[model samples]
Target: MINKIVAIQGNHPSKLNSETDTSVFLAHEIQSKNYKIFYYDPKDLSVINSKVIASGFFIKFNYKDKKFFKILKKQKLNLTKCKFILIRQDPPFNLEYISATYILDTIKDKVKILNNPTSIRNVSEKLYSARYQKFMPSTIFTQNISEIKNFFKIHKKVIIKPIHSYGGNDIHLLNKFNSKLINQFIKRHDHIMCQKFLPKISKGDKRVFLINGQVCGAISRVPKHGSFLSNMSKGAKPINVQLTKTEHKISKLIAKDLKKENIFFAGIDFIDQKLNGDINVTSPTGLKTLYDLSGVNLAKIFWKELKA
Candidate 1:
């Protein structure tokens, strides 16, 4: 018999925001389809007797509840029994994250894993965009202060981001370079992504969702007053928006490439019609926010395409 379980290898459900978390949105949808939700943390994953197992709880998600989730049972589960596994953890993409992917790599053939563990292992969420630099704003990846200073000199205004962080954390927009700050940032993050600050970011950025290699839907996120970051967690507001022709073209190309790379779902951003270099394959978000804004449910598309 086919397994009816969908394992979510992620942070605990209690830590997720039902209002905007794509994992919660996805679980809520799959649960409606009668699939049991097995939620686990990366640290809970183990391999013993050649069986990959997770020490976690079966849970339920109720969007209407003040407290959104309830643990049904806590136990150890052999991951191979699950028909699907969603790697939904947020990332600093450190060693722990890599180790989890390596563990998951063992059972990828037995269970369907979104964004494929091996692919996630190989793809750096930020650095992977280097292949499409022609479609992106002028950008550089380096930890060397001298190279960063030269980039700042050329670009004038620059956006600095840690190579592994998520949700707008540790990101900075520098109008002018400060050696002390640059050195400090380098020491903390090791290597960073520096890009020409797109002044048009004040207008907002478009986050386009790709499912099974198709550009399914999109929404514009306008940064709050006096901010350049457009992440919802950073106070950016989502609004109904349509993709520009250029945006669609770039998105389609990237989507196809990601599909070839074994990535089933992704989100890419555009600022001033240029790729922002954030190809979010590792736990891509915004589906919940997109549905709320325009009533377009990519979550439905997501499951249907997977034939789950």
Candidate 2:
């Protein structure tokens, strides 16, 4: 039998926002069920003598406390012993991240990993949305300057993003084609995601949360003044919002596809009912913010689904 423990492979708790972190929120809920929480950073994961292990510590989470989390004891753990392991690290999705997934893949049969390591490794967060391009704004994935120029000519306004980045970093809004900027961006990040700029983003974007193949909840994040990015890390304010019929339909289709791919949790974004190309499976967030605005505890739903 699997022990009542959930191992989280993520960043240090101190770096997380207590009010909006989904990892800690889920951990806290699972802890209430008397499941021990083992927390570790990706750097501490390793494979030795054909076994997966991690240097980590047991932790307790408290939402109302100023400190929020407390470390109980430090230990080296065999990851296969846990009932579940969540790959909750933030991403540039570089070699280090890929290596961690490879290591975790070895123990997957013995533990329930939220995303299924192999599946997350195969799904590129931004690029995967291409499969649903019909629901998305006009977008392209390329490093070709000429292709980007053509896209710009058609759309007039465009947004350029590093395909593997997270937290709204290195995203640029270009009103007109600038050869220098486009060339420099391509040189810096290689392949990139370029899309027609959505004007409605000034109002907000909705992040729909899918857990266990179902559209569980959603929250709208309105960008701060003078910004186009609606990520919470970019100071976007989340508000309670209901999904439109179209949004609900799109989310359901995506959720069904993700489940078939063995992805257990994901977040997808939309602006003015049009899908933005972020299929956020790599540590998808927003449960805490949703709860804060709507009083719906997605964390409880998360665990209940896992139990079922």
Candidate 3:
């Protein structure tokens, strides 16, 4: 039998925002169910004698508290002994991230990993959205400068994004194509995703939470003044918002597809009802913000669905 332990493979607590961190929120909810939370960084994970182990610490979370979370005790754990393992690391989708997934894949069957490690490795958060291109903005994934130049000629204004990045980092909006900048961006990122710039982003972008193949809730994150990036971490203010029929339909289709892919939780964004080309599977966030805005408490739904 699996122990009443949920091991989280993520960044250290100090690096997380106590105010809006979904991982801590979920961990707090799960802890209420009497499950111990074991927190660890990716570097702490290792395989010895074919056993997956992590050197981490027991942690307790309380939303009402100023500190929010406290480390209780230190321990080195055999991951297979835990009831659940959450791949909660932020992504650059670099070699180390991929290596962690490969290591976790070995013990996936032994523990209930939130997203099947093999499945997460197979899904590219941006590239996988191509499966539903009809719902997205005109987008291209390439490193070819010529193709990007031609794309700009057709689209006029475009947003350039690093394919392997997250949290609105290394994203640029080009009003007019500058070949030099495009060349440098391509060289830095290798391959990048360029999409038609959506002006409606000035209003906000809606982030929909999909848990267990169902649309649980959503919040509109309005970008800060003079910015187009709507990521909450990028200073976007989140507000409660209702989904339009088209947005709901798009979310439903993506949720069903993700469930089939064995991704138990995800977040997808929409700008003016158009898919934003990010299918956030690895460590999808926004639960705390959702709770703050709407009092819906998706963290409760998250744990309930897992238990069910």
lDDT of 2 by residue, 1-308 (tens): 67898999999999998878999999998888999999999999989899898999999999879999999999999998999999999998999999999998888887889889999988899989989999989999999999999999999999999999998999999998999998999999999999999999999999999998999999999999999989989999899999999999999999999999899999999999999999999899999889888889999988898882
- Cα RMSD (Å) between model 2 and the true structure? 0.9
Please say which candidate is ahead in lDDT: 2 or 3.
Answer: 2
Would you list the rank order by lDDT, best first?
Answer: 1, 2, 3
Flag regions of model 3 displaced more than 4 Å: none
Mark the 10 consecutive residues where model 1 has the least summed lDDT. 9-18
lDDT of 3 by residue, 1-308 (tens): 56899999999988889889989988888898899999999888899999999999999988788887889999899999899999999998888998999999998878899888888888899999988899999999999999998999999999999999999999999999899998988889998999999999999999999999999899999999999999988999998999999999999999999999999999999999999999999989999898988789988888889882
lDDT of candidate 1 vs native?
A: 0.93
What C-alpha lDDT values do all the predictions have? Answer: 0.93, 0.93, 0.92
